[model samples]
Target: MTAAQRGRRVLVLERANKVGKKILMSGGGRCNFTNHFVSAENFISANEHFCKAALSRYSQWDFIAMVERYGIPYEERKHSQLFCLSSAKDILNMLLDECSDAGVEIRSHCELTSVSALDHDNSRYQLKGHQNQTPLQLACQSLVVASGGLSIPTLGGSGIGYDIATQFGLAVTKKQAGLVPFMFSDASKALCERLSGLAVEVEVSCNNTLFRENLLFTHRGMSGPVMLQISNYWNPGDTLSINLLPDTDIIQWLQELKQQQPRSLLRSGINQKLSKSLTSELQALWWPEEADKPLAEFSDRRLSEIAQKLAAWQLKPSGTEGYRTAEVTRGGVDTAAISSKTMETKHQPGLYFIGEILDVTGWLGGFNFQWAWSSGYSAGLNV
Candidate 1:
């Protein structure tokens, strides 16, 4: 029934009016809650095993089972991303319903004033927030910090997750916005602006890591699936390489075209594999003068050089869109001090950290929400 009915105490503090605000907006309204391709390696954490324990305890199949229970029709898209037949609200309702079933009390619109441990043992916590008339005080045997990270502030993202950890003598890793769009500098901004609305399938590289997907050009900067994937690894002033032609051996393709059509324009030869707008933009960037040159006039060495340039077009991003537009936060509460099996703080008993608040962050797609499901279940079951 209610908290009073069950005689079990619980308090879930939600800063915004909407508890699952981000959950509603994710995956273009259909929540990609979890994926079939899940492993400890897919996540980044201070202690890799921290996620392994929880994830193994509550696997992707567990969430899928719950989804099946709700009878939410779903389909597997590319990369094993599962989308709801309707909207993300179904997933949110499922979670809320589960929490209710467990006799969990969700306190919405309640801004946490402060959190501190009660005694030397640090077994109990004191939580302060405004209630019906005045500031209210809450003492609990356990405190679970699932407040999330500082991404999409409009969606109730906050550092409140970190604050609780810090107050309890826990370590928090450096945080940053990730899986967000990249913005170019003023000089390069003009080119990106000029090519706005043009999207092409390409391979994007940031240092040793590379991602192959569709890249979109925006008036402000770069986005789309590929760019968003690479943005997680991109840092300020770091060089990024874009392969304009992903699958084609540009030189060989052009050589054959040159023999077939001796008077063909250089742009036309490249356009056979690439979009005309993208080909024009790349040709302007690579060989502006040769944009009008006949393919027959090009030598093998020149073609090879063009191929190299096309395969690797490097540019350094000035910065990213930051937490406001970030899909998920990069860092959070360090996992070293927390128990991997239980998600409980080692030093502070009954103190737990789960979801995006912890250091574990997953790649784009359904990974992050998977972390939430696994980690949340771990804490919920154990606590």
Candidate 2:
């Protein structure tokens, strides 16, 4: 749409039956299109500064203005995440409306099988593909690869963008699942299964990165905003430190409760903040002997130990759920070989890479969508 708006003839070839499948499914069907506040700090990239230029040029406000121009109702959630008030289809319809107005042609189920330079200076290119079984060929001067990354194959995610980058001699980085759920195989797995469907607000930390959000217990593992956010910083064999009671100092609160309510059981006091089932599980794991004992019956040292355990419970995860459930891919084409300002490959003139196909992954929320808008706009102006 941006390219067409800039008076450049644009043709969008989509391998899926329709365009914006991911957009239609994001944010529980109400697309979290962009954030209220976005900076380079919100993204993870091999070159930390690679996304700054494009983001600055086409910020979140620019996208918001477009949303408002279409009169799409939106609402802001926690952490400044902006989501469509009705359905994700609204955003998709707005984009399609813009494309239609700009005279952009979209061809669905057209896969590009191969591409080659047509001239010595690489000014022109030949693209060969099949549009639903029929052979197709095209020639163009500028090519933009927005094929996206490998995450949720059902949503049209593919590695064709990375393959094209490597085919052109551009370095491709190691890719992994980001913003994915963690699966446990140890005793924690049983605990999680037993407590499946339970959600608690907590601060989960790994590799010195902390995220304070809701942690949800699943039959297979743990998920929700906190786990997904910290998974980006976690690696194999890393232990996660979870603070069940992050808003309150457990030690002081417990001590005061012990003095004020001598007959109250430890489980009873903890049950006030945590669910009864979770508190029971913790009591069995941390202090089985004090399950039926009153607060005054326990010594201060024992209470402190329980407090420490509650403050920092250690749990190691077997691994993530992988690309099957990941929100984004961690790495892709190395940003070192790409121009940050225009999103055009330095070594391959007229070839531009944007969005998740690059080594830029944003934090959970609407950061990733913002990168798509900014990078797409950058390449649109130059392509």
Lowest lDDT 10-residue stretch of candidate 1? 1-10
Counted clashes in each candidate structure: 0, 0
On a 0 to 1 TM-score scale, where does candidate 1 land against the true structure?
Answer: 0.94
lDDT of 2 by residue, 163-265 (tens): 8998899999889899999999999999999999999999999887899999999999999999999988888899999999999999999999999999999
TM-score of candidate 2 against the unseen true structure: 0.97
In TM-score terms, which candidate is top? 2
| Consecutive 10-residue window with the lowest summed lDDT within model 2 | 117-126
lDDT of each: 0.83, 0.93
lDDT of 2 at 245: 98
